[model samples]
Target: MFAGAQVSLYPMADGFVGVILESLSALDPYRDQLRIETDDISTLIVGPPEVLFPALRDLYCAASASGHHLVLRTTLSRGCPGEPDDPICDTSCLANPSEPLAQRQANALETLRLAPDMGQVADAQFSLYVMGNGDHMAEIMGCIDFLKQSGTFYKSKHFCTRLTGDAGAVFATLQQAFCQFGPANGHVTIDLTVSANSPSKR
Candidate 1:
């Protein structure tokens, strides 16, 4: 499987150059776990979901907290045809990982609270795993309905749906989708990949 993200962060503030550099530095520590490449336009990171999500959360949280208006734009892809395979894309790395994405989100949310309001656009992809018995298709449709009403959404051929909206609201909606609908009887899990960008095309 191929799992990777190409991201670009723009900090809108005075002395933005240093701010951007410092903000992007947050991903440096994950060098061992991911294959990261940075160029003139964006940074591309390839790895498994376990490491990918945490790294993205940390990087976004740090960049948003930089006391400046920030915009993050990214294109995330996985399982695309003709893609190269990599070991890190497998689920084995997460079998016993110490920290998971849910935990990382808690921390990211804390930091994101301090970020100023800038009317940014956050885009994300989610694959809801509907398990257990009882109207799985109905439940999936329900989730999709809510998301569609919540913001802009696109159903991709890659088997994931994309959503875009205000950063806070987008994540909050996602949290709700992940938490509430998976009732005690029904089981569901979501794999999410998110990105944000300011001054987006409307």
Candidate 2:
């Protein structure tokens, strides 16, 4: 029932400090809904899936608005056995594991369709980890199928999948993958890197 993410933002510009500090304001509206702590390394956001992903999207969008190359590295997790459950992390957005995989995929795709466009483009890659036993590969493969049809899927990589499109849809796809592909109450995590306005593209 607990969900959270460790996020670090990198702005590939001379005024990186200013960009990072200013973009943090994007999380202001979410402060009441999430537990956020920032230090030298990364910012930790603890909250429900509903709020967590949007907060990340807003933060990235705010920074990318500077027209500088920006990268966000995030590790998102839920139902970690090692972490104590907190009421603030409670959410009803998770898929029921007992539900059929096809139904879950359909639900995920529908959700992506409704995702709002954040007016920014993003290129991202991530690996979803479904911890604990019980047909993990089936769940992962099912998630892969969902990604391909997500409209943001770019391709498959060695150990992860690549996604590109509007920031909103991309992040929504990630949220669905995190929530729907694993056991309803099992530990699940994602390692993700998102980029915008990269000079390498030019």
**Judged by lDDT, which candidate is best?**
2
For model 2, which pairs clash? none
lDDT of 1 by residue, 103-193 (tens): 4334334433443333545667777666666566765666676566554465553777887665555655554454334332233456666
Model 1 worst lDDT run, 10 consecutive residues: 92-101
Q: Tens digits of per-residue lDDT for model 2 on 1-202?
A: 7899999999999999999999999999999999999999999999999999999999999999999998999999999999999999888899987899999999999998789988999999999999998989999999999999999999999999999999999999999999999998999999999999998989
Full-model lDDT for every candidate: 0.61, 0.95
- Which candidate gets the maximum TM-score versus the true structure? 2
Worst 10 residues of 2 by lDDT: 89-98
What is the lDDT, from 0 to 100, of the residue 66 in candidate 1?
Answer: 66
How good is model 1 by TM-score? 0.53
Clashing pairs for predicted structure model 1, backbone only? 72-196
**lDDT measured at residue 131 in model 1 versus the true structure, 0 to 100:** 61
Deviation in angstroms for 4 in model 2?
A: 0.3
What is the TM-score of each predicted model, taking all chains together? 0.53, 0.99
**Clash number for every model?**
1, 0
